[model samples]
Target chain A: QQQVKQSPQSLIVQKGGISIINCAYENTAFDYFPWYQQFPGKGPALLIAIRPDVSEKKEGRFTISFNKSAKQFSLHIMDSQPGDSATYFCAARPTDSWGKLQFGAGTQVVVTP
Target chain B: DAMVIQNPRYQVTQFGKPVTLSCSQTLNHNVMYWYQQKSSQAPKLLFHYYDKDFNNEADTPDNFQSRRPNTSFCFLDIRSPGLGDAAMYLCATSSPLGTSGYTFGSGTRLTVV
Candidate 1:
């Protein structure tokens, strides 16, 4: 199955609040997980990523928390700002798939002032 | 800085007409990808190129075809543009399939009339 499910198809948060988006996968062969951020009319850019070996990874205001046993991972945005309003996607792929990323449905995050 | 570049940020096509989208990368990555994203939905991967080798997704439509002339240039061709084919086409690049997240071009928006 090449599906990665993401929850809260849309999210709304206040400035300086915390934004959380969750994703789940069915394939245990997926060892790499990454999150992408896309602005309107633009291509997606890698925001943050994590491997099963690490439970959590934080870069700047973004963080990825992974649970290998549960086949789930989440993106957490700290000190959310209006500039962060955009679409967020979670993707996973097996080590041998050669960069074929199975992507989630995506989360439309809106940070209101 | 290393990045991906796409030409013609927007495209307008008529029914039965064909259109081509281009993407180039300065990163010198060995892999390139094409994706389609409709409004309010997550991006869907259509296919990718690992070096000079191409990998096609099983569900990709027959109307869609791709060509990679060299390591840095890739093209997405829609033989017959249809209303359903109107969406944001994104191009991405990475260093081999097993590598980390990719760098993406701004994308081309297609509108079929």
Candidate 2:
């Protein structure tokens, strides 16, 4: 019930194209959802996040589209660049837990120029 | 420039040897977490500390232990590391409410030979 399932283990996109990653969770108590980007030899960093109350959230080239009733969410990268190539993980923070983050398996996104 | 910091980016230990990974935070957050990430896998939560209180995952191995002597520093101790223990250990910090996001350190890569 605590798992967050992500799809498309890997993705390949051309420069200036749109890249999308999706995730779904079984826990209904999850209110905070965040996406993290990880480069080689580095820890995952927060990319963007959304709460269940909002249907979408955008930050620069990244956006999060959420569906509360479906228990799913997705990240959209507009004008994808090579520098955006990294492992992206979707995580959900349980409402009851202080800081427990449940992460997906991760998606490796490769943008080809 | 406040962030989480981890020392010794890379560490190598022999089988059955003891190893320790340290993490510190300048964010002065009340929550600290330890996660283990194998290549191409999701980051698995091993434990976390909410202030001085410790919370361990039910599936976390007995060999994995943690210590938080004070608010600024936390440590992950592997009493007897095996080959399967080789992975990247990540340390993260979050505020009391955690509405923002968890800040992760660069992480320590442990190689068990």
Q: Which candidate is the best by lDDT?
A: 2
Q: Which candidate has the top score in DockQ? A: 2
Error of 2 at A7 (Å): 1.0
Model 2, B15-98: lDDT tens per residue? 999999999998999999999999998888899999999999999999999999999999999999999999999999999898
Clashing residue pairs found in predicted model 1: A98-B97, A99-B97
| Fraction of the reference Cα-Cα interface contacts (below 8 Å) that each candidate reproduces | 0.97, 0.94
- Tens digits of lDDT, candidate 2, A1-113: 43799988999999999999999999448979999999999999999999999999999999999999999999999999999999999999888875788898999999999
**Model 2 chain B weakest lDDT span, ten residues long:** B93-102
Model 1's lDDT to the true fold? 0.90
lDDT of 2 at B34: 97
Clashes of each: 2, 0
Alpha-carbon RMSD, candidate 1: 1.3
Residues A1-113, model 1: lDDT tens digits: 54799988999999999999999998548878999998988888899999899999999999999988888999999999999999999999876676878889999999999
